[model samples]
Target: MFKGLAVLLVFQLTGEIIAFGSHLPIPGPVLGMILLIVCLRFRTSGRLVEDIERTSSGLLSNLGLFFVPAGVGIMAMVQTVQSEGIKIGFILIASTFLTLIVSVWIFIQTRKVVERHRETQ
Candidate 1:
């Protein structure tokens, strides 16, 4: 577990250093995750990778716990939320429906292309 943690932190630190030095807009942790993915793909059969995978799986299984702080922070801002509740609610609803419509359209188009390709094959 300690070794796995050390590996994770090392990648994160490397990402942070790169992001800070290059002044990239992306977050260090995000870049670190990408680096970790590439490393994992390269060493898929390694015992160390298996350990890391186990550790990551355990953390992800309890990922909902990580959102508690954000939920509490939102609760703390209840008054602000109340004041702009309607606008916020409208935006959320609109964006959700818009996303659904776009997703369905894209899925239909993709399915059509796949069906056409199958016919050609």
Candidate 2:
């Protein structure tokens, strides 16, 4: 776990450096995640990567526990949230509905592609 954490931090730091150096629109953490994903998708497997996979799996399996602090933070923001809450609520609702519609459209398109492949086969 410690080793895995160190690697994760390295990725994040690297991403931060890339962000500052390149002045990218995206966040460091996002780039770090992309880096990690690409590393995982590498064709060659090694002992170190295997260990990383184990640790990452363990961490991901307990992701909900990590969100507890965030949940608590939102719970603690009761007073501040009372003001300007309507605008936030509207944005959240609109974005969620937009995402849902986009996801459904993507699903339908993927299904059509799959259906076409099936017919050709």
Candidate 3:
């Protein structure tokens, strides 16, 4: 478990370094997750994969705890949020629905394409 956690952290650190060095738009942790996925896909060691799976499961089991810091930070900015709350809330809600609609549309289109390909085959 400890080794798996260390490996994860190392990947995250590597990602942070790359992001900082390249000035990428994506977050370091997100890049790290991408790196981890690529590594997992190419890896042949079952033991390592199992360890990572176990570690991931443990972290996800208590994922809510990770949100505490964000919640606290939001509390710290309560005054700012309150002043712009309506505008912020509106944007968030609108963007969320738009994203959902766009995602569903893309999924439907992709499914149709796949179906056509299957039929042709």
**Worst 10-residue stretch by lDDT in candidate 3?**
44-53
Weakest 10 consecutive residues of candidate 2 by summed lDDT: 43-52
Q: Report RMSD for candidate 2.
A: 3.7
Task: Score candidate 1 by lDDT.
Answer: 0.90
User: Candidate 1 vs candidate 3: which has greater TM-score?
Assistant: 3
| Model 3 segments more than 4 A misplaced | 98-121
Question: On residues 1-121, what C-alpha lDDT tens digit does candidate 1 reach at each position?
Answer: 7778778888999889889989999999888889999988888797788778777887799999999998999899999999999999999999999999999999999999999999999
Deviation from native of the Cα of residue 1 in model 1, angstroms: 1.9
| Global local distance difference test of model 3 | 0.94
Find the candidate with the highest lDDT and give its number.
3
Tell me the spans in candidate 2 whose CA falls farther than 4 Å from its real position: 100-121
TM match of model 1 to true structure: 0.68
Q: For model 3, how does the per-residue alpha-carbon lDDT over 20-103 read when each residue is reduced to its tens digit?
A: 999999889889989999999899588888888889999999999999999999999999999999999999999999999999
Candidate 2 structure quality by residue, lDDT tens digits, 2-115: 787788888888888898899999999889888988887883587767667778899899999999998899789977678868987999999999999999999999999999
Candidate 2 colliding pairs: none
The CA lDDT of each predicted structure is: 0.90, 0.87, 0.94
lDDT of 2: 0.87
User: What C-alpha lDDT, on a 0 to 100 scale, does residue 10 get in candidate 3?
Assistant: 89
